[model samples]
Target: MTTILKPLALAATMTLAFAAPALAQDAQPQAPSQAPAEDKTPVTPEAWAVHLQVTDILQHYPAFHSAFQGPNSFRPQATTGNTVDATLYAGVKPWAGGEIWGNLEMYQGYAPNNTLGAAGYVNGDGAKVGRSHPYARIARLFIRQTFDLGGEADDQEADLNALGRRRTKDRVVLTAGKLNATDVFDTNKYAHDPRQDFLNWSLITAGSFDYAADAWGYTYGAAAEWYRGDWAWRAGVFDLSIVPNNAVLTSDFSQFQVIGEAERRFTLGGRPGAVRLAGFVTRGGMGRYDDATALALATGKPADAALVRHYRSRPGAYLNVEQEVADGVGLFGRLGWADGTYEAYEYTDIDRTAQAGVSVSGERWGRKGDTVAAAVVVNDLSSAGERYLNAGGLGILIGDGRLPHPGAERILETYYSLGFAKGMTFSLDNQLIQNPAYNRDRGPVDVVSLRLHLER
Candidate 1:
């Protein structure tokens, strides 16, 4: 605990020192609103936007009694881990209907025990590849080209991936380069963005929709979106890792994934709402759980997913919805399922998942810039997948050596974020997990986290 406190204190001190001047400038508080309305005027074509954000998260678990533990099991002893990330979003409108953007991120830290032993790991920001020291990488470098059709125009907010501009309601957008598949598919405004919203992996997105990516959750891909009136459709194809769960991506497209999504926008009770149905198909050399288990039984050795690998196709699908229930409250839900027979390629080890949650702004409580959210997720595996784990086969994120008694891994997470200063927020988060890694004989783990975020 002392070691954990040291890093936390150091981080806080550094952050405050850097933010003090900014805080002083904001001492003259202004009236609170749901959100500051954006200026409708479009920026110049040559204009550029530069934004930076930093996030630090510290997580700990209390000692819990365990009947049994294994190589990949969550240890009974108390454990703590932290992650810090800083990203720079830079974009420019190089020409009419075109924007070029790039994102560079510096990441430092690791997940708990390198992100093992839980279907819904506690931190969505925890990269798949853990590092002890800070490192820089290009998270996204892409070009977007939009073509307008005759229709009414809408103002696009300036955000991480969008330029501040106006575009027709009916348009076609093409994006090509390095990016995340989820950036355009299965998105839920209330539950995504770990830096500001939910932190659990299962809550951030459908736990079972195994979109393709490298270890850091980004891949080389191209996506096209066609928007007409209140409906939009998108499709993309991306490269998979050279090997399942590996850090390197395959350049030759020997292994690839195809994704499609349809979205509909509507107004319910005068509040905006959206529903999206997304599906993905991966064609690659993959292994089957039943085959892995059988090989281990025949050879009297530990189950190895690689020994039974063959080129095949895996498929998954999910539904996403987010609706504004009130001026400051919104609801979100997701339902997902995948081919349980095949081993998971990316993301976690759940074959089936469901989630529901709500996010509320603090305006109702007079803390207009604050936010609070709660969500619950249930993740399960097929009988064959359970057997593979029982035989000591590892999937993407979880395998507890054995599964004598298997049950769906259930998690409930909640968080409250307070805006203490301009562009700075502090959050306290908690999650209760049961049947971790689908092993019923194991524990119900309790995890608590403190998060600090700064943006400019």
Candidate 2:
């Protein structure tokens, strides 16, 4: 714990030093009204808008019980990891009903074990690839066009990737270009967005949805959305990686994925809530778990899914729900399932998953800018998957040398966030993971993290 504490202290000092100027500039902040008077001003779109955000997370885990270790196993030793990212979001209204937005980001650092050893990895902000020094990339560059369908007008607030504008309640939105599939699908208000809410990979989105993306979680795609009378529908087509879990995206549209979702919104006891059902299918070169295992046994070699890959489709679906049960209190849950026969094309190695959580604001405690949340998730693999893993086959993130005893991976996470200043927050998070990587013999790991986020 001493080694972990030292880096934590240094990180805290560095973050405070970086945030002092912003905190001093906005010393006094006002509480935001729950509902501002509807802006009745004639519908007008902003010409341009700019927003920026920076986030740093430091995570540590103490030594835990482990019967044995493997190449992809979580280290059973005390360790610490950190990640930092800064992003600038700029948008412009190019035409009356169209907007173009771009996100320029710089990122550094890596998660524990280079982000492996668990299906529900600890840090959502951690990327598959990492570097010791900072690097820059255009995370997102997209254009959106809206078509009004005759309904009451609504004022849209200016935020990341969104330009302040007025639009009809019933409208059609079309977006195209490079972005994350989760940005449009499997969204939940209470548990998404690791910078502000739950930080576990399973909590960020449906674990088995396996949306298309490169190693960085972004890909070229197009999406269309329709909203009308408490009902919404969304669909999209996106380019997949050239090969399973590869960092390069397909440039010729040879491999891709298609996704569709339907949502229903309603008022429960006068509180807003919504339910969504989404499904996806990816057409790509992949291998079946059974085939890989059989080939490995026949050849007396370690199982490798990549050795017998062929073009096929992998399908999956999930149900997502979020409800504001009470003032400043929210509940969210997700259930997901995927074709366990084939190797995971993208995302973590989860065949089925269930997640649930709750969040409460500090308004009840007389601190409106504070929040606390807790969540739990369970992940499982199919019989075929189990056999392949036990036979020494490796998936994208998880693959021990062998699996003698298999068990579902279960995780519990909780966090408390303090909004010490406007647009700035500090959070303390902890997670308890049992049967990591579905290996009952490995361990139960405990992880603690500190997070600092600032935005404008």
- Residue ranges of candidate 1 with Cα displaced over 4 Å: 1-46
Q: Give the candidate number with the greatest TM-score.
A: 2
Candidate 1: 10-residue stretch with minimal lDDT: 1-10
Tens-place lDDT digits, model 2, residues 208-326: 98999998889999999999978999999999999998899999879999999999999986689999999999999999999999998999988889998999999999999998766
Compose the digit string of candidate 1's lDDT tens values, residues 1-456: 242334335434543443344345445565778887985676433367899999999999988767877777788889988999999999988998898999999999976767777989899998977789999999999999989885986657777777887778899999999999888888888998888888999988999988889888999989999999999999999999988888899979999999999999999866899999988999998899999999999998878789999999999999999987666778899999999998998778989999987777776657888887777788999999999998988888877777889998888787889998988999998887888898878778888999999998
Mark the regions of model 2 whose C-alpha exceeds 4 Å error after superposition.
Answer: 1-44
Residue 36 lDDT, candidate 1, scale 0-100: 78
Provide the lowest-lDDT 10-residue window in model 2: 14-23
Spell out the clash pairs found in candidate 2: none
- By TM-score, how accurate is candidate 2? 0.91
